[model samples]
Target: MEFSRRAFLAGTSALAAPLLLAKCGFVGGGGGSSSDDADTLTFTTWGTDAELAGFRAAIAAFGEANPGQTVELNAVPYEQMFTNIDAQLQAGNPPDLFRVPYYTFGAYAGQGQLLDLGPYLSADTQDRFTPAAWAAVQNEGSPFGLPHHTDTSAVLYNRDLLTSAGITTVPETAEEAWTWEELTGVAQQLRSALPADRYPFAYNWQGNGVTRWLSLLFQADGAFLDTDQRTPLIDSDAGRAAVEFSSSFFSNGFVPANNTTTSASYASEAWFGGTAAMVWSGAFQIPDAETTADFEWGATFAPRNVRGGSDFGGNALVATAQTAKPELAAAFLEFVTERDLMADFCRSASLLPTRADLQGDALTFDVRPELAPVFAGQAATVEPEDAAQVASPFMSGIIPVLQDQLDQAFLGSQDAAAAVTAMAAGIADATR
Candidate 1:
């Protein structure tokens, strides 16, 4: 997770252009003008060069296949994407189709800004997606988007480091996966065996870090929100244990003192620099790790407690409610998400496809041979039951409060039980 300078430049440029357009009162194609023309469709999304390239290839393929239809792609930087889309929708000029982060889909759909896609979905199309994939875009028994691609988190370890710590076997399957206590014991061993600067474990300790925490809560058989998704459940017994287990890593010095301030790049640096033995990260890191690391590394399921589950994070395609050409937008969405095109896109972009059938080795295993199965295995653990319980519109609003209280517990300002209780209280207030 090193952010390339090119990505930063592209993000800044994309960010500035939208603000300039808003300041000039130039509402581009508001009031559904762009979607009214059957020959053309506007699609908005954000990605890096590789992702944009994959998308462009798909768009070109769609144009060639449809013969008179033109698909225009508007790609922004990842950082400014959601804000820019919010602005465009507010100005009443959203693209015919746009990318939605699964977690935020509920917020926009709840506002009646996105088209309910249930009518457009057929049995055949629905069958193409995995249950977890389909569950990600639905709200209150209606579909708002179509699945694009997905990924789940896993623990990547430095094999050489582990072997040096007198560990011969690494957990390769869920049946053999380490428990939280077992993982902490191994981390302790590595802490003593490694150099003074090295820590035992690290993760992306920003917003994504909060996702990892949620996974831990699930592994402890806890829920963030109740079955209705409107009630806060962060004060449950499982929640307290999850928080205490996580806070101990920091309090016991298994994690660095400056972890809260550390960025993803710093964590990657520690892992790649051989100062850290393992990283709790998503499957997207496999390609980068294979390219840069000199030492041998492997990935496995995230340590399990009572049960195991991983966070399924990805983007999906949705049509705006203002789209005048609903059929055309739906066609384009189907075109890009078709089985062959999606498989190619996932292969080219090094992403995990949302299709259950595409989980074969022919796509990613050929590239990063060692780590692909671990990712695939982790993805298999992301069940529809977990999605129904964990994914919520309130999540976007409550994450900041949850993160703040967790940080306080980690830094010793509040005890774990108190922090968990406060987080639940804060979420209850927000939802009310």
Candidate 2:
């Protein structure tokens, strides 16, 4: 919960990359309207069945509390949500409210495409959220969105597979989680025991998820960008160690070769298909895994380097600046984040809550409640500084750099040192 009061950027240029506006031509208000009634607000999002149900329930409750308000839910596939939002934003008719991942929130907020909640929300509202969650929604020291809920990655393993590989004991607590060397040994043991076609594990770094790889860098005490959020800091000794250590997962045959950043297969898919003994995945996968897997599976902490770290894997709810009813939209956001409502959504969706008050034994996960402690413990390792860096407005620009550079390193097209150099250079270009 270590929070920083200093602004993330020193100038407007670093606040958000100009490339987004150029690519999308989001110049604000154009013409169309979703509805004639100012009381009805259109909400766009991509979510699982449970997640959508939670939203519908919250919207129903909001409608009951406020007589004239209505929230129409427009749910789409995850792949198409952003594309549709961008088109709507460019046409100046975006939904009043939309769901956005924390990493992608900065792009919208930076371009001034989002409504600032400071004017609509209470002064003490910031105190309601965890420091790391609040940090993710801030830009230029102001709140642009609300941290609805959060999730983090952990190691999900097939119990029968691990037992077959001569592995019995697993880290039950975050503090007892395996170190990098210990994990390597476990992978080596699995590799020796399993068939050649089968692999030890699969990493969830496909597509835009390349940002999750930063857990290793942060664990090694390296920062992608310095405290200013502009300078590149990924060319140091810690950077090299992270690069070399992660690349070893590929070289040592610990994870599948197709587990590179740009691979078509996801880590969970690999685990489901019995191609991997373990998979590094987020807590959101629990409900599906619990129902889908034939074998008994369990989750453990992600391996630690010098310290434990994990990806901040959840989305935020933001109201568009183009909304006709800003006050009503802000009210909905606040209502959804209330203690009881947030806890219900998290319980239903198997996600972690961002509210500081909900992080306790009082809020039990409905699905796989026994594994909740491991994920909660792993999520606690994400310091406020780590969340702040990931939430930088430049992440949209930096994602491609991480995707391309890390893929090369994993493919052995570039050495660790060269990859670190290219990454630093790419990050420099991205922030500028």
Candidate 3:
């Protein structure tokens, strides 16, 4: 979930790296034997320069706090990170700890490849994180990992474009966020004012980001799966409404024709390149847009429907079942999620914090401090139930289903109902 400006924009256009699941023939194996020097541990993660530096600072602080404890850090590219971890895990020699997205954490935990931290972490540790964040790292009621940080999508707009379109007033708070009908009307106005080559807005659903579309479904008070996480609930009224609304972005020419979920050009490119007036994006893009954008820009809350909602976008820090130092690994996990450490990391990296104490107006960013509250507002809208569904072990399989079906819907190859039906069937199979 930590991305520098350049990496974040590039990632939006590329297909997400394929998850290395058990189906890929990675057989189970035990971790390294207990080490005599338990104080020394190895950790791995992928991050931008700023994020890596923040992590290094945190590790140094941990070393200071606990004498003789050392954490060797291994930095890798995001695309190759999981594949490497899977290889090491299969070899029974994985790092003591590694960073994982909430969606991917389930696959490892479900397979018993991750340590169950419930035994090591204090019971009060649960209260440190937001309910949604705590739920993201849990599997079957046990804490398999800890959500280190989180990010959420908001509306990043070009100031001049809105003024040219005669739209001056914008939502200042999440409670005042634009409704679906209001957003559609805004898009309509922007569309009339924009040139043939430009668009009113673009959605950040390209590639594996297809998961982001769930925010709209959630806003409509719809669940992709029932409470059991085994049944599809995406063929109902909420599903249809969410799909129809998003599909209108394409059919009604509100967004660029090439901005479909499968497109090579992503929403960030359109917004920054001046082809669109506004872009649905996350705070991770703030730094990049702040430096490179030629026009005036700012952020606002994402559109709401029956309720407000946003994508729970971020990664968690987890210990491997194969670590030789379980207690030390758990300690490191606890240290990183501490209020001060998490806040510092989030501020430096242009990401959101997961700690309950640091959310909303509690922590300010080093970059674009004023815009921090907008993303905080978006994060506040993420329901714990929505987070739980997104953090499912089946997400690796479900992502492709969403990409294909949603792409078909946006491309006019399928209608909203048809897409919803296809997604339901695919999800049922994936969960099965």
Candidate 4:
């Protein structure tokens, strides 16, 4: 949830280092002997202030429920979490449990640094989660973690701008989403109506912006990696089309010329400042928009080319391979993910819930009632196949390469076809 350009760039460099010496057997460290000391479990996560407070409160509740158990919360800055965890794992002393992003879940699971949660989960429990959220935590065929929370992407539009531009019909549902061409036509109309300094779209090209590209790729019916996750499929025709379509917005002046600058808040800034009519970004923007913007605004699924899809971003709770008490760790995971508890966490943290059943009914943020359904709809409608593309372990390696190529394409240093080919080559080399 605390994604920043600096943090993501730092993580790319840190993740390239080896985290584990080798894969070992599944059995974890033995549970501590029954002394007078309470069973101590460590939970490592990254966040500050309000986010950290939410985790601490949840852990305190868990401790109170299970009287003699004590769970220590280790809070790290977002930029240092991976490096810190990698060092702990290599030292053979990781926290009993930790929170990890979906992209890194595959890498840790592949190296056998995470406990397999598949055996611990019941069918009914698994069914409680949205399918896409459940699939995001799996490595190969096994689950290494439980889906904690999710954030999906959508198109945030200025209702006043649309209305001023004579656009009466705006997409309110996935089924009624605009096509790429239709969106372009609308942009053109806004361009004529708005001031010259304002653009029609605000494209985020920093931090987890690669996920934005993944959404466009999926919408074009392209996969980032093959089913095996060993081969790169980013050079396909659909992939080329996705990149080309995205680049065209900037090249044609539909988006700001400086859109490629690496600022985490650029998208929101542009929208709130009235420099742009729309922003394709995550659901996290909903809270910010409600508090900052004076104009009438609404959200809907991003424009569809071949199909409707959005970037899936979130973290999951996993038991470490070095946990001394697997049962206690699993219990903590369940406690945090409990239906009512998770709803509270999501509302307090201003995040999207992972549970399909709780999304609409349990969400309590009352600031933007209309936008809630849009975020919930995007979260619930994630295609299982599209989620699988993002869940690939290969993505952790391919992301840096893809980001570089995307920057080149956006800056006109490379053509979309050439950039796609370079991305494919880079991914192939990384997987090998």
Instruction: Give lDDT tens digits, candidate 1, residues 342-400.
Output: 88777766678988788756447435756767777777777664565445667677778
The residue ranges of model 1 lying beyond 4 angstroms of the native Cα positions read: 1-36, 261-266, 360-366
RMSD of 4: 7.9
The ten-residue window of minimal lDDT in model 4 covers 15-24
TM-score of each: 0.88, 0.92, 0.91, 0.86
Off by over 4 Å in 4: 1-38, 48-50, 261-265, 359-364
Extract clashing residue pairs from model 2. Answer: none
* Order of candidate numbers by TM-score, starting with the best: 2, 3, 1, 4
- Cα lDDT tens digits, model 3, 1-432, are 111323322322222122222111112223463234556778899998889999999999988887777788999999999999999888877888899988788889888999888777755677788978877877766788989999889999999999999999899999999999999999999999999899999999988788899999999988886544447888888888998899899999999998888888888999999999999998988889889999999999999999999999899999988777666777788888889989989998889998889977797888899999999999999987787777778888889999888878988999999999999999999999
Q: lDDT score, residue 211, model 4?
A: 65
**Whole-model lDDT, model 4:** 0.74
lDDT of 4 by residue, 160-252 (tens): 888888987788887778888988898888888888899998876566556667888888877777655557788888889998988888887
**Alpha carbon lDDT at 400, candidate 3:** 92
> Which tens-of-lDDT digit does each residue in 58-134 have in candidate 2?
99998888776688999999989999999999998789999999999988988899988777675557778887898
Candidate ordering by lDDT (highest first) = 3, 2, 4, 1
Q: Which parts of model 3 are misplaced by more than 4 Å?
A: 1-36
Error of 4 at 297 (Å): 2.8
